[model samples]
Target: MRVLIVEDDAALAERLAALLGEAGLVAETVGDGREAAYLGCTEDYDAAVLDLGLPQLDGISVLRHWREAGRVFPVLILTGRGRWSDKLAGFGAGADDYLTKPFQHEEVVLRIKALLRRAGGHADPVLQAGDLSYDTFAGRFSLHGEPLALTAQEHRILAYLMHRKGAVVSRAEIGEHVYARDLEPDSNTVDVLVGRIRRKLPPGLLVTERGLGFRLVSEPEFRD
Candidate 1:
């Protein structure tokens, strides 16, 4: 999954980015709210961690702008504002969840995971599609009840697909969520990775729609 971290604290942002990355998410950190607003509108983030105190613009305004632009990614307010009113404002401004400062990094990861699961219409930490299952909390995948080993990139691709299972995901969309902003992947990168994943998956599970894109179907009959 992909997440945006909007925090003015450089050190804290870096730490959160590292922790989220370790949790199998492609995390991008932006210190300014204006930049955050722009990226949130333009990028395909699964979720975001936003701080109320941001440079150039406040977090509330940025979030409001994103919502106005119809960007529906789940956002968790991570600020030092612990008051109930502050939290109400955050929620009023379109935050999906709230976390105060001096929070545990692990909790942040868990909250992000929960937001992702909820956004994906999944209540449980373990997401299942046929014999393939992904434990979002454990950051592990299982096939036919056995552990599935995948490289970091492969894991990200599969996780993103699993979250949006049954929908055709374009390669460009995959690239945006799978890689960091600075790293521009080659045009064939997603095709190569998907091919690798297809080899590991059961036949007819991951289907290609030629000019369209790829979809992970729970049943073989759903394939195009």
Candidate 2:
């Protein structure tokens, strides 16, 4: 899964990204609130870490705008403001959870994991679809109670697809979330990767719509 980190403090953002990476999450960091707001609205992040004191726009405004735009992904507020009123305002602005600064890194990770689980409709820490199970914390996938071997790219692709289970995700959307900001991806890389992933998955688990994109479904689909 991928998460967006919006913090003006470059050090903190990078640190959080590193921590998220170690925890099996792909993290995209943006130091500007306006940019964060834009990405938060446009990107398909599993969750987001938003700082209240942002440069261009405050975190509350960003959250409000994202909510207004129908961005339903979970957002956790990370801020130095400890006042109860601050938290109340954040909740009012549509933040799912709040964390004051100087908190534990473990807490942050746990909060994000909780948000991810809820967002994916998972009642447990492990994300499961039928016989397919993925341990989000370990970045390991299991099929029919056996470990499924997958390359890093393949795992990332599968994780994203599983998170958006029934939605038709385009190759472009997959690329945006799977690839790093500095890496230049080939036009058909996602397609190739999806084909590779499909080989390992059970037949009919992954489907491609002629002109749209790919989707991970719980059952087989009827072809014309």
Candidate 3:
């Protein structure tokens, strides 16, 4: 899962970014609303944490522009504006959820998870791919009832794939979601990371699609 945080407050932005990162999601931050709007339109973010008050452009405008551009990623408005009108404006501008300031960091993470689940058409917090189980809320993976430990990069790649399980995902798509804006992955970076994940998973669980890309299957016929 990839998230974009658009907040002007440095401390708040850093804190939110760190919290989201700990939740096994790739998070990137931009302090300006113009930049946020551009990134939101350009990047393949699963969700966004947007602040209403912003520099260069306002959050409402940024969100409206995104919607006009047909960017349908879930957006949660995290702002100091507690007025019902502000929330209405956010919703009218195509926000999926709203949260006020002086909020709990855990709640932000939870809301983002719920948004992701709903966006992916998953009502449950846990995602199943064959014998592998991924707890979206806990940011943990278990295979056949055993815990599966993975590096951060591996986790991002697998998480994105699990969210869109059974569908072929290309290397370009993986790079967009797994890596942040500043970290442009090399040609073989995704291949290497997916290789590591394959080592950790059962045989045929993650399969390459030849000229296509990769797919995560919920039912894999493993053979020796």
Candidate 4:
């Protein structure tokens, strides 16, 4: 999972990034809210940790802007304010979860995971498609009770595909989801990754849509 941390405090941001990275999340930190808003709106992040007090633009404004723009990624508000009104305002501004300062690292991680779970439309961290399962938190994949070894990129690609399941995801969409903005865009990257995943997956699991894209079809389709 990729997370963007919008925080002005350099030390705190670094600490949060390190902790999130240790938890197997690709974390990027930005000190100002303008850049945060831009990235949060344009990029495909699994979640965001936003601070209310920010430079250029306040975090609440950023959150509102993203919400207004129809950005649906889950957000966790982190700030020094811990009052009832503040909490209410944060939720009113479209934050999925809230965390106050001086919090334990474990608590932060847990809250982020909870937010991700909710965003994924599943209460559990593991995403399932028939006999195949992928653990989002653990970054692992299994097929029919057997552990499947995968590279980090492969794991991310498969996880993204499995999350969408029956939906056909285009290569462009997959590229935007898996790679950050800095990476070079190649039209065939998603297809290549899908090919690799197909070789690893059990037979008849992944389906290609010719010129369209690919979909995870775990169960056999009924036809006349």
Model 3 clash pairs are 130-218
Residue pairs in candidate 4 whose N, alpha carbon or C atoms collide under 3 angstroms:
none
Each candidate: how many clashes? 0, 0, 1, 0
- Tens-digit lDDT track for model 3 on 164-208? 898999998887877886786875888999999999998899999
Of the two candidates 3 and 4, the one with more favorable TM-score, higher being better, is: 3
- Relative to the unseen true structure, what is the Cα RMSD of model 1? 1.5
TM-scores vs. true structure, each candidate: 0.95, 0.85, 0.95, 0.88
65-122: candidate 4 lDDT, tens digit per residue? 9999899899999999999999999899899999888788667777886677677677
Please say which candidate is ahead in lDDT: 2 or 3: 3
lDDT value for candidate 2? 0.85
| Candidate 1, residue 217: lDDT | 87
| Candidate 3 lDDT score relative to the true structure | 0.90
Kindly list the per-residue Cα lDDT of model 2 for residues 34-104, writing each as its tens digit. 89888887776778999999999999999999999999889999999999999999999999999998998
Cα lDDT, all candidates = 0.90, 0.85, 0.90, 0.82
Candidate 2 global TM-score: 0.85
Candidate 1: stretches off by over 4 Å? 221-224
TM-score of 1: 0.95
